[model samples]
Target chain A: MTNRILYVLALSAGLAVGPAAAETPVTIGMITTLSTKAGYLGEDIRDGFQLAIDQGGGKLGGVPVELVVDDDGRKPEKGKQIAERFIKHDKVKILTGIVFSNVAMAVVPKVVREGVFYISPNAGPSRLAGKGCDENYFNVAWQNDNLHEVVGQYVNDKGFKNVYLLAPNYPAGKDALAGFKRFYKGKIAGEVYTKLGQSDYAAELATLRAAKPDAVFFFLPGGMGINFLKQYAQAGLNETIPVFGPAFSFDERLLKAVGGAAVGVRNGSQWSHDLDNPANKAFVDAFRKVYDRTPTLYASQGYDAAHLIGSALAATGGSLSDMDAFRAALERADFDSVRGKFRFGPNHHPIQDLYIREVIETPEGTITNRIEAKVFTDHADAYASECQM
Target chain B: MLLILEQLMNGLQLGVMLFLMSAGLTLVFGIMQVINLAHGSFYMVGAYTAATVTQLTGSFLLGLLAALPAAAAVGMLVEAVVLRRLYSRDHLDQVLATFGLILFFNELTRMIWGRQPLFMDVPDWLSGTVELFPGAPYPSYRLAVIGMGILVAVFLYLLFTRTRLGMQIRAGASNREMIAALGVNIRFLYTLVFGLGAMLAGLAGVMAGPILAVEAGMGEEILILTFVVIVIGGIGSIRGALIAALLVGMVDTLGRVFLPGLFRLFLPVAEADGIGASLASMSVYILMAAILVWRPRGLFPAQI
Candidate 1:
């Protein structure tokens, strides 16, 4: 009797349902720098991305998705290997989530050549934005130099004529300082590039003190930023000359590590937790509820990446086969971003507003970023014009 | 001149921190003939424990106090279980085992504390800059670090030359089996030495927590530098570790500060900075190489 009832129900459902209602589950391969000193970055972005997926009921735009996460261990070779495994074994339709620019460069070129849609949650390297631009690549985050350029413009707006610049000696570091110089019409009192991950910044801090610039600008991220800020405050230079940086230095996670040292420091960012928008409020509230901590800019970017993918999937009906339709849907960017408003420029990088955030000390003795002013409006990246594609 | 002096002080501060790490590492190696790569894990443990305790109790001193014994206990436990098995093993085996221990401890820390770096604030009294000389101000926390390091060095010196335990340790370093044959409870001695080394590392970690980013795998980076210190200073020699650590610290600090300027005197702006940056990063290793060429057994090899 039960078998007869199941057969009748199955026959009724088959007769009622449309023939075109076949749903394909989308698989996204996320390769990031995890399981190292910089693992927190990957962890944050992963959490943020997962949070979005969770909030969307484990589906993007009414389509189910399987998210495969892998740790790159902050090595380019490891990242490349993981990318290959993702492409070959996993058959991941869309690739996203590389925390470091080096790893992004290593994996993006090879995988994008295979006709996979690559959406970056973080690390918008200039090479990918300019001559190396590809039709499939979409950077949900700002170009690497955007925040630093915002700082430069902010410094110029603040009327600081003499500024000292410092960053780690690397490609991103070079681009950061160059971006700063692009907008700031000021005398570079001194320019220095310290070694990457150099924890003891006393030598550089001493030189910074001696140079006596009106303002100091640095782009030391991760542990480097924590060390620099702590030492800078200890040296009492924070009392004399104002220090400015990109949000990478003064993010929520790092601000907690640096404690009171980073309080009152101005940094430029494309997103802040306190941005007053319905979409941002929902994202932030849901994120804090799930994670029990404030989300960083990285987390925001990851959330946006998920939403971007979701919008495209919704438009294209969970299918990545029609390249034109998928590309058009992604280009439309018809999703509510935590950053308020976002649009992909010609190079598929964000053309969004950058905000100046001040690290403020609350009455409860917690340090967090508070948006002070809009530094740039609808800012397109410098390399977008260079991208012939 | 003041700038030079300040930079020197900075160097001294870095040297002192490294001394704390190398002292423990050198002692463990000298006594046990065990290449414990997990020595840095003790440092990390100390820092993490201190951060957690400090956050719990709202007292920085209490956190530091807690950090020392926590790390020492961990060291003793690891020795009792894992390190004891590796003593008679070959150097390669010991290296492999200790490396596994490093990974184990790193994952363990991650499981307990999560992935984010912990924050340890400098105590209120030690949080500001103090005038080191006329018109020259320095961080009090750094000065305290220098002072504590010197005190530890002096204590270690006296302990080795003036105390029975120290003598036993020195004896063990020179001839382990002979000391065992001479009715010394060699096992207990090794455990004690290991604990002491762990305590020193823990102390360094506790002191360093306020300044450095206290996170997982923090030990590995500093561990390399500590190894360099031991190699350059002569392995298993505290005095050598001390001297070599100071030298390495100063060379590294001063090189980064002044090398670019020196290069600019001879080359164009871009070329000078490029060469200077690379050379500055390499100066400490260069010094290590030069020292090794002159003294292969290290500058102060212990008397056999």
Candidate 2:
């Protein structure tokens, strides 16, 4: 009796998943780092997608959609497995939300090989924005370099004579460093490549103290950033030197731990909570009401990805067979993006603006990211031209 | 000199916290003769519990108090159901089983907590900064962590030295056969020791949550360092785990701070910085490697 009841419960829950159009059912395969260190960002991305779908009244272009969430555990191998599952078993028409760049790198090729549309809401590795870009791979997020360029320009604009570069020792880390150096025309006193996912920052900070650079530019996200910021504050350099990075380096989730120490540090962002756009304002208000917290840039990308998918689905009249049609539909970028005026390039990455924001103290919570300056106005990513597709 | 002193203190503080983790891990491994790779999972569980309770109840003391028993109970349950069957198994089998436990616990956390990281707020009483030296204000929470570790260490020392159960545990460590012959309930004792070890790990976890985000698989991230601490201190030695953990923490903290400057003096600025950064990151692993080369049995072997 218990077994039958449990089985019935499971089946009923499974039946409850789709949005309600009752057209040809299409599955969206999403592989994200939902079970590991970067799970917080993954959850935000998931929430953004789900919330968009829920608020869209469960139908994308009069077609019911099913989403299959697979936890990649931030592993390339796991991501590949999910990609195969999506392609083979589920016949997923769209693949999305591989949060980590490495995981995206692992999964995107499968989506392309299978001729399914993969919209990367996050993990915009520079390679994809350039020669490696696939026609069907629409990125709702900016390339790794584009966001870094915002901070790079800000650092240059501030007229800092010298700066230190900090990032993890990985492909993404190297790319971020190169991206920062691409625009920040300053004498680099030091460039420290930390161990990937390194939990301690004392030694790196020691080198920084000795170098005494005008500022520190870091690209650590998730727990590594949290650890680095904590030790950096603990090392007593919070007051001495300024720090800056991409918006992912500090957000509502992170500010809660680093606290006042994370304050006074400036970072470049694609969207601040206080962005001046009606679409963005609506997103922020609606997101705040539902989640009871400010959505990070990751969430913003996710929201945009879902809306873009919905728009494309409507444009195609919910057709899955016409590959060119779906590709063209996604490229239109007609969705009301949380990040303003997002238009896709030939490489399928967004051409959008980036901002510089300061972490301010607010009465409601620790997050008070106010736009201190604007870096890119309708900026096209540097690598877009290389992407002939 | 001032910088040196400050960095050193930072190292000691980090090291002591690591000691708390290593102590629990080594205790379970040595006395129980069971390789509980899911030991860190207990810490993760404790921290998550503490964060949830504190968030719900708005009291750190109450949260902490709840965290201990909750973690202890989890530890006891794990021992009874999963670990009890594997006591007679080889280390390889034990590792595989416990490693499975780690994955299970991580997945369980995700399903329960919905994967959004919870930020634990520091209670007002412990949130104030204390001046460790003239003009140097350290956050009262971090100092509290140090104080907690010292207190736990003292308590552990007393428990092992003064109590009858401690004598039995020590006996169990030396000769399981002899202890079994002595008409003691080894099965019950194992469960109790596992629970105790779990409590220690949970204490470490709850304390750590206020600083770190209470998220899934945090245990796996720290598991590597905890392993390093165990290997350096010695397998099957609580004293060794404590000493080695603190040593590693200090070396790692101090190395990262000073290595680049030392390299900058010798090499070109960019070259020096890169090499120094990499070297500083690898310094702890290097220390571990060196220790292993010299003393395969570790700095303090538990016994013959």
Candidate 3:
């Protein structure tokens, strides 16, 4: 009778121990633009983040994590809805992976207010880096203007007297031009704000030609950049007036689409696949083996974000009961980044080196960006001073 | 003066492309009395097919040839399978069904081609710029597009006015029941018209592939403009479609070019630029509204 009672007690104890040892995976919600023309942006981020988690055997820093992903479709309202669902319905404490500034702006402010930690793999708007900074917010990506600012500085150094500027009429677009102007003190021949998602540029090109700038600087991301570069080349302006933009337009996949049109064009970036770092080499090789494609800056950002989160999770032993301890751990940012050196400012945005990369045709006859020079070393965002924190 | 000339040429090129897209959409709506939200999907299908074929064969002409038939076949299949069931249904139901088709085709392209935008380079012969005048250089490919648009317009005119199929199509558009009573296979006729419309959209897609990023959902970007063109031209009237497409295209292009400069004369440069860009995007829509107010049945309503 005593043996039977002891066996029942042992079985119940085993059940309790199994549940505790296994532990419910800490949930991380990712709302990203995984559809529309910008879908590839999110695909790279998700793939990179998944790679890190997969490396940890469905865990981050030896802590099991459940990642719930949903498509924002590049819509602000849709992103907000997904964030709400993740926060309330799923009871997720962590959020990440938004590709567009508008969607991030709409979703981040609200979620951070709800006491959920938001790690941005991409899309670091200036406002959030400034007065809107929150303890719960951290950006593994550079601020929206950082890459553009690097190009602006490079253009100024190149002795371009008059440069024409163009970007979509949106917050990020405005920030891009502002960032360029901060460094480029040359004469602005003309400035144009195009409609968001506009594919055609004939009319704009006509005026640009008339303006007679020595060079052109544009920030049309994704498919917009592809159309612009092709048309720019087709118009016979490429040979006369050089073109430059941030790395968003000159990503690996986009360069393939732009072909010879984008060759010789200079773009600013914070990370490259060929960065001379052990961590970067490992990442590039592993990513190519797993995904069978070159990783864009976005993929690098996602990988960094996952590792950053992993560092914090490791320090806290994956426990989030003490918010202060978790926040402090994240602020430490104890991870070896693929970008060579990376750390967060007081605003939780990245303070890192930026590089000027030139599009070149490899011996294999494929177009890709190669680092030409380091533009800035340990550069921080202009808005960092405004963050009281 | 050179800048103005170049801008005008740009406007003409844009108008020609719009005509190609609107002609097919107007025909389907005018004849079948069906609202097809998925008209753009056919454009996407054509582009994807052309891009794939061009990459494989290394010949733009072969890609164009393949895309036309492929798009037509897909359109015919969709019409016979899905659209046929929605013919007698309410306009709302047709809209819903065709909208579903848009999602279907967009996702289908993604599944097949992956998410990356495909490259479609301009044929070597059409890669350079042609000097229209001493100082005005234009892309040869765009010139070819204009020429192609004119050829299609002429061909469509001859097909509709001179061919027996054209008469049958026109009659069917006006009175489907009467045409059926007169021994015409109305269903087959409708299918042919849909195929023709899809082919024209396909042609637009193939031409646009060289200039634009040939990616999934590319159709929807220009689809709204196509709708505006058909609405302004009068539904089902090809002549009106031609005129309206050019008009809308010119307005859109010129507005984008000149509006900010005009506004700068009065307002601050910054405010003027912002307002001008916003206004330029709205110019076609505003023109459509004005046209609707003046001619509620459109510029040329079908009078049989």
Candidate 4:
């Protein structure tokens, strides 16, 4: 009976195959956290990658490209399952789109094992840059701590005598604080680690209030950043002690949530929507025309990843086996990156410029970041030394 | 010295707000014998409702007023349709059903509000900081939350203890079938009680909206704290929930503030900060576990 049922299922599966499967496109599988608190940034990453793909008219080399999206829900094991399905089931030659380090960490290993190339648009984990950097893996984004170190430089440059640093208590959080301390040369008032994705900052706020630091540096991203900023403003400390943070801490999504509170706040970024470059200008115009809102760094990185992969495919004449040719194409890096010229260092991470941005009121009464100064040019990450790769 | 007092006040304020949430959860558990995980969804709904109304009406009072009935209606409808069926089922079924409700509520909220947080203002009357002590001023809005919490505790005590309705509720909690045999219209009672619990949670939401970001998934964070409150206080005991809620809130707030500083004395600042923050984050859960070890059921188990 089981054999008969299996035979029937096999016969039925052939019938379920639609005519749409015959004229197949280049299947590109993108997996990221899309169902939890981090969903907004994940949406930006997905849309940003798709915008580039869409602009290519659903084709990468005159062949239609099919984009498959899977939500990891911020779980590493789940990400691995999705990666397996992408490679084995979906047959995606190049896999991309992971926002968190753990998710990328889980998925990249499996992809490398199968010898399929994985392009990480974000989550530039130190491990991947050094010993973990596979020949097939290339990150269009910089090492995670590069932007944070720039914020650290800005803090020291401003000559704040006493500063307090706060981040969620996690591995990534440790990297952020470590990055800040590397370039900051003054007396450190205090360093704090709070619960990862913690909403309540009252106790920490009370302590910071007591410490009376000149400025507070924080690395709370996504919803955590939104909560921290509102609470900080409500505690009447917004203007009293200036807050220094990175691009991820504030973005188009955050500005809408923050309203007037985000105004005049200085946050560092490698790219802002208001950045005035020829490539950036063209990218911004095209993105706004398409999405009807400003795109964040998540989107920009996603766009860059799509372009990088497309260029690699183009360089190899759309073949997956030419590893040397693909590597050479990626190394030449001859694509229009919205953040300006970014080249992968020896570790396969972008060595790029960082910008310190201040939130300003636009003529249309929307809050947007204005580039204050270029903090780093061809900046290297702190953890590169730790990575022997 | 001054900082200690200020931090204490902050902790107390957070505790009072949490009491509102615990009161609802514990009551639902005590009476209905249903572990409603979606209790936080009601809180999320109430907060979003209050914020949207405030934006539309431009009157904080009106928003608060409309939000009460809106939240109560939503609660009553949910209990009538979904929760009523789960009351007789296993705890696992109840948890699964309510968990599904959480997903539905989160998606519904996102669809309506478009995933951005809505800002509600502290009313003009309660916007300024009050001089609670000499050289120490606390936000008047937070102080109002404390006052409102005390009022809720008093009202719940009167309703559940002194009034005929209170007698019926307690009696029903102890013997649901017996009360129904007495022709008490048990269905009506459950709906009323659930609605009341929802209002309590909604009140907490409205009060907290200005201080916390008013967004979807906001309730899940508070819901975990509310569970700790229920576990510590004794599930189904309103009075237990009140005391436990305040205790958990104060401990959590104080933990976030002082735990790291305590560790700072011994460990390097970086290591201390890291360890301190992690421990502080876990303090309330640790407190709950300790309470469970001492009193397996809870501090004041309503069943016993």
> Which candidate's DockQ is highest?
3
DockQ of each: 0.78, 0.29, 0.87, 0.49
Better of 2 and 4 by DockQ: 4
Prediction 4: B-chain TM-score: 0.98
Model 4 C-alpha RMSD to native? 4.6
- Native contact recovery (fnat) for each candidate is 0.72, 0.33, 0.86, 0.48
What is each predicted model's overall lDDT from 0 to 1?
A: 0.91, 0.82, 0.93, 0.83
**Which tens-of-lDDT digit does each residue in B1-304 have in candidate 3?**
8888888888888999999998999999999999998999889899999999999999999999999999999999999999999889999999999999999999999999999999999999999999998877899999999999999999999999999999999998889999999999999999999999999999999999999999999999999999999999999999988999899889999999999999999999999999999999999999999999999978987666
Counted clashes in each candidate structure? 0, 3, 0, 0
Best of the candidates, lDDT:
3
Please rank every candidate by DockQ, starting with the best.
Answer: 3, 1, 4, 2
For model 3, fnat equals 0.86
Per-model RMSD to reference:
4.9, 6.7, 4.2, 4.6
Q: What docking class should model 4 receive?
A: medium
Q: Positional deviation of A379 in candidate 2, in angstroms?
A: 1.1
Error of 4 at B8 (Å): 1.1
**lDDT computed for candidate 4:** 0.83
TM-score of chain B of 1: 0.98
lDDT of model 1, residue B49: 92
Q: Residues B1-304, candidate 4, lDDT per residue (tens digit)? A: 8888888888888899889988888988999999999988888888888888988988888888877888789999999999999888999999999999999999998888876677776767776567777766567777888899889888988887799898999999999999999989999999999999898888888988877778778899889889999989988998888889878988888888888889989998767877887788889989999999999989999974
Output the lDDT of residue A260, model 2: 64
